[model samples]
Each structure stands twice: as C-alpha cells, then as structure tokens.
Target: MNEAIKSVKLADMPDYELVKSGTGGCAGCPSPMGLRIVGKALGPNSIMVMTPSCAVASIGVMPKSCYDVPVLNVCFASAGASAAGVSMSLDAQLKSGELTGEKPTVFTWVGDGGTYDIGFQGISAAAERNDDFIHFCYNNEAYSNTGVQRSGATPKYATTTTTPAGKSAQKKNVPLLMLEQRVAYVATASLAYPQDFYRKVMKAKSIKGFKYIELHAPCGPGWKFASSDTVTLGRLAVKSGAWLLWEGEHGKLTLNTPTKPLAEGKMPLTELEDYLKAQGRFSHVMKSPQKDAVIDEMKAEIRREMDFMLGREKL
Candidate 1:
C-alpha cells in the first residue's frame, strides 16, 4: 500500500561497496547477494549491462574482476539492446560535450534466461522506447547460468533441468509484464527485503524511463535449498504469499516492501507449508500423491497472486 512509501535505512545506503568481496557466486548464491546489494545501489556512477545469465556467470571473470563499476558484457538476446546502447551512448557523450561527469547509470543485469525468455524481445523493445536504462531482473528462477534449464521465470510445480517433473507453466509475472508496458518503473524485489531491497534500488535510481526491477534471487543450487536457506528462502517468499512486494509508478499501483504486511491481512500466510517444505525444487511437489492436491494448487495460486497484487493497489 504505497501511500508514498519510501523508507530505506541501512543507515540510508550508499557507502559504496560496488560488489567485490570474492564474488564468484554458488555457495548460497543469492546471485552474489543480489550483486552485492545491486552494486551498492548503483554507485561508482554505474554501467553493469550484463547477459548470458547469472549476471555474467557470477560477476566478472578474466583479469579477475568483481565489479567496482563498468561491467558491460551483453548478448543473451542483447540485454535490451545492450542497455539501449549504453543509455544512448551515454546520452550522446553528454550532449556532445564529450562525456563529462555524472549520468553514467545505464543498467541491465539479466537472467531468468535473460529476463523471462531470451531477453523478452530486447526488454520489449526497451519498453517501447522509453529506454533510458535500469532493467535489473536477477530472478533466480531457472536456466540458472545455463544448466538448471526450465526458465520463463520457472514456477508452477518447480523442478527443473528442463522441468524434470514440474514447471507446468505459471510463473511469468515479470512485474505484471512490466506493468503492461506503460513502464516508467515497475518493481517486485526480494533478496528477502534488505531494507526493501534498499528502497527499490534507491527508487530505481530516482527514475527516468523504462525502469524495471524484479529481484527475488534465491537459488541455492537451483532451489535444492539449504545453502543456509538463502536468506531463509527469501524470507519465506515474502512471508509466504509467494513473493509479491509491489510498485508500478507512472502506471499507478503501489504496495511495496513485504507487500504492506501482505496487503493488510497483517502477514497471516505463515510461510506456505514451511515454505514449500524447504525447496528441493518443491521436492517433487512434496512427494506427490497429489500432495494435498498439489499443496492446494499452490495455496490457490498464492491466493490468486495475492488477489492479483491487491487488485493493482487501487489505481
């Protein structure tokens, strides 16, 4: 219920650690703690245009980098056309003044097989040309760095390595498909709410155009779990209404951080059957015998997607 909800305080972010402590992800990989808190809220000016999964195979490779800024790898369906050509060639080298200071915030650290399948038409044509930058997507769902397979943000009965037994279509709510493309900003976030993912990456870097978020990175070995339960299974998937922190901006909807105590019911979902019995990709839908009708159809599709994101938070 975002009646203008902006509250971040891990002592108000920005002490810049631009993701560098031994970053090659895997042991409890929440994508290297969601790329070290989104590269410390996009500081060190910021470039990060990645692709080919797991944010460029777990933070930089050769010459042993782990990002202090300037990442740029590209191509898994061209991460929204290489972050819209690095935000229009750094806005034409700062309007022909030949690139000065400030204004280096281009983004795109895709994965979920490059944002819900082959870089979803280059971030839906860079959100129909509103493309200035910021397009995150960490989404540890599937095709996790090219081995776990089954991705269109894989969900439904879980399991993967090309849906070994589950994933019968259901999980692509790419921030309500980027708020149905009216995109000025859209959000979901979840490395289990580190200050609501640092106040939504400092409010999507104080917005511009085509900004998207979609965080939720929790694939400790592709959901087999217990790499210290990846931030307690991303806080039991937002206290078990199954990941629905919200935000839409420009096109309206709100409901941020823990989704307003799970939309005013005061967080009563009590972690979905012990968070789907602690992962193992839903442990073959919890050892099916039609495991209580597939956990009551995943608790009625998490109460019909938390009542379709609290009925789009009124406007």
Candidate 2:
C-alpha cells in the first residue's frame, strides 16, 4: 500500500466501528476504503443514498447494515432521485420542526454502470433541478459487480465480457457530461491521491447544489491486476493522461493537476500496451494483429478526446 493510504488506519477513521468485521464489503475491497475516507471527510451526520450496485452490496442490506450513518438503498436507476427526495424530506422536516438534529448532508453513491447508463436520467433530473446533494460515482471503468461487463464508462480497447477483445467504441466522457449539466460542482478524484480525494469530498460537502465527483476506483478482479497494484494502475492512468483530474464549476474549468499537453509528446504506447497486455482481459488482443489495430485506433481516439477536452485547437 502507498504510505498515504496505509497511514489511514481504521482506528483513525470516524465511524470505523460501523465497518468492523462481518461487514458485507469484499474482503479486500477498495470501495469501502474510499467510502470510509469520504464518509469521514463528510463527517458523521450525513445520509448516504446507495443504488443496486456493488456499493449497496458492499455496505450490506438494511437490518444488517454496515455504516454508522443513515443509508437508503434505492434501485439502481434511482440513486440521484432518491438523494434529492431525501434532501427535500429533510428540509420539510426541519421547516416543520419535526427534526431536531443538525442539517444532514445527502450523498448518492453509485457505480459507473449506474451513473453512466441506467441512472443518467435521474442524475440529469437532479442536476437540472440543482438538487442539494453530493453525487459520487466510483468508476472502476466497467460493470464490475455484474461480472466485468462493458459499460458506457469502459474505455475503448479495454476488454470486458461485452466489449471482448476488439471493443468498437471509445469510453464515454462522463465528467464532461456532468459539466454540460452546469452543475454547481464537478470534480474528478483518484484512489491514488487519497489526500486529494479526501479534500475534494470535504469540499463537495461544503457546497450546496448538485456536486458530482467521479472517483477513479480500480477493481482488482475486473482489471485482472494484482490486489497490490490498484494504486499503481491509478497513478499510471493519470501519468498517461488517460485520466486527468479536473473540475468544472459554474462554467469555468480548472485542472486539479498540471497535465503535459499531448502536442508536446504522446503517451508511451508501448507502456500502455504492456499494461493492457499483462491483463487476462486483453490477452486475445495481444495475440491478434487485427485486435492490435483496434487498440491503436482506440488510442488515437483517446488522443482526440483529450485534445478536445484540454481545449487544443488541433490534434
């Protein structure tokens, strides 16, 4: 584990007892760790709205819950709406003097599958209304809980059960989608940068309307990477410019970290190729020339996408 990640012992974490032994999160799941850090940053008086993705499963079902704070398990497509509803209900209660506690922070925790696909409509509605809540998408790049299937968020050339070895399309730009919604806050964080991730979560909590955070979470089983390599892969993703941290607030854009312009130099294709090839998912692509061509085309698409995002006039 990285020193930063390792430094956060469970004892040092708030609500740590909630995640004690017998919790439903995967034995070594990074999702809970990310959530724990986020929950801590958000503080104890928050309500988490989880959908029918790994988050719901990991946190366990009600009556046998794992988290110390209040949690609402809604359907996969209703995370954002549920959060909005909860926020409204809380406001109503406060107005009626029916609730006597501090204002509660509402957070919607969804997977890439939920946010990038099925839950988009609800998310859009919430953002359109400028709902008061923090929406988090722990993007592992695919439908990891449903057996590593391809999702709208899955990158091109990445192998998933649905995409196979020769994926035909590029990954969906989800953060850009949120930016287009003109949400009050939109930021990207990675597990590799725990402090940054924690700070962003805290910042989002302090903000008032439709805050969206897309967290780059790596899945050991889905990515075919070693359990110990999660942070490494996350770092490599940022280093390659495949996943740059940035924020869009009220129509202005600011990159969280300085990114080398693609015009200056291209990402090392060989390094990316080796990283992909080492994974069992991309094994077939490594053996076939046609598949290699597809991978190259995908890389070009990524370059094009990045150029557009970074406001480059020409590729």
Candidate 3:
C-alpha cells in the first residue's frame, strides 16, 4: 500500500453549505450525509448531475430541493453524459471569460442501480474519454429507491424483494472496473471513516480528468437494521475485511484505512459472523440449512479479496 499524506483538519476545510439537514431521507439513510460531505469538500462552485436514485428521491425532488449547490436531475442512464455536458459547457464559459472566478466542478451522484447497471454504458464512455468530473456512487447494495429490489451491487446471500432466496451472483467490483478505465483517480470510502472519506473527496477535487469514488452507504430501512446501527455496520464491515478501502491515482493502487491493516495481516480479521448477523437482510443466510456452506463461501471470497489487495494473487 502506498503511503498517503495525512489529511488536513476537518475545521480547515471549506464549508460549501450545500446539502441541508431535515431532508426526506429515511432514518440512517447515508445518502444525505455523503452528499453533504462531498459538497463541503467541493466548496461553492460545484454542479451535481443526479439521476433516478434514492438520493434523488430524497433530496432532488421537484418544488423543493435541499441542496444549496446546483443539481440537475436526469434520466437513470444519463448521469455521466449529463455531467460531461455540464463540464464541457462550464469549460467553454471559463475559456470565453464569461464565467469569472473559480470554475464549477461537475459531479454526478447516483446509487448502485444507476451506476453498476442502468448507467454503466454512459459512465464507461465518459471514463474512456477522461471527462473532467467526479462520479460518486453511494452503494447500499440494492435498488433501494424502488422497494429494495436486487441490483448488480447486491452482495451474495443477501435477500431482497427480487432475491428473497438470497442472490446467487456476487456483487459487482465497481472500483476495479473504474481502475481498468485507467482514470486519474478511483477510491472506495465508508461513512464510518468520516475523515478518510472527506480526505478522498478533497483529493479527487484536486485531480484532473475522470475521478470515481464509491461510498459504502448503509441503508437502515432497506437493510432492516436499527437506525443507530448505520455507523456501527459500516465500521464492522471495514474491520471484518468485507469492505476494502483503497485509492488508485494515475493507475497506482494504495490500500487505505482499516483495510490496509487487515490486508497487511497487522490486524486480525473481525468475525464475519458478527458482521452478517447484525443485518436483517442476512438473517436468512444465518438460518438457512446451508448456512455453514454459505458462510464458508463468504469467508473464501474475503480471503481471495484480501490476497488480491495484498498482491498475493489476482481476485
């Protein structure tokens, strides 16, 4: 893992004052908090391209918007394209001297449904072109906005409305896909590490060309967990080595946060059972007759993932 310089104190960062509190997000919905953190990191000159996602349903609704920064709501598949257009238009204005002062940073905020499935084409095209913008995917592991349906981001053994028997497929490795695009920056962040998340957002803002960050956003209602357990689940996920935190800059990968220690074997892996039992979505996984097999499968996957991150083998 490449070393990362220590980040600045949170108080020293800019206050964009964009995302407001008391939004329509459900209790423990991490979307609003994630948006707020990104907004503050980007400061005042920022334009967000939104899509048909839980975040949009919560904060980008018509007649009343909770964001202080400009948000353009597009179709589910158009977030990347829309943001690219905005970035080009802003660049044109800046070049023509029509837009003075600092130029607005273009960003697209979407959920896993929009990112891993519906909007993948547009996003892939934008990444290939090295578009000047940031793409943030707040993944809660399902189509959380539309009744907790299964999505490409859904983890194996997690039951959703469409996958009540537990999903047979593995979750999409989105960050690795972005890295394959050879973009300027790619990272994974968890709300449990607020400062780490904030630091990545700030780092992305400073870079040029395409940037992608996937945030591990825990959904309270969708996952059937206590609202207060949102942060706890996030922490456990990292400690358990189920979710790895890392950053890729200019094609170089560096493990970050709790993942670094786990991958390096400096820290013992937290019990996967502890993390799985805490979420109601995985209740079936624990009670199923094949529970032992399912648990072993999950454990194998984690080991393979950790080995890949530590450069022992490809995942």
Residue-pair clashes per candidate? 1, 0, 0
lDDT of 3 by residue, 1-315 (tens): 223645767787566677776578888889987887887788878999999887888774576788888889999888889999999998899899998888788999999999999999999899999999999999999899899999999998888999988889999898988876679999999989878888888888888889999999989888889998998999999999889999887667788867988888898989999999999999998888888998998999998998887782232
lDDT of 1 by residue, 235-292 (tens): 8888877777877776787776556777578757675879888888888777878888
Off by over 4 Å in 3: 1-5, 10-16, 312-315
- Assess each prediction's global lDDT (C-alpha) against the native: 0.79, 0.75, 0.87
Candidate 2: stretches off by over 4 Å: 1-18, 258-270, 290-295, 312-315
What's the TM for model 3? Answer: 0.95
Expressed as tens digits, the lDDT of each residue in 124-200 for candidate 2 is: 89998999999999998888887889888887667788876546686788788788777888888888877778767
Show where candidate 1 strays beyond 4 Å: 1-48, 54-71, 74-85, 99-109, 113-131, 134-140, 149-156, 161-183, 187-207, 213-247, 254-287, 304-308
Estimate TM-scores for all models.
Answer: 0.34, 0.86, 0.95
* Residue pairs clashing, model 3: none
Instruction: Identify the leading candidate in terms of TM-score.
Output: 3
Q: Which ten residues in a row have the lowest lDDT in candidate 3?
A: 1-10
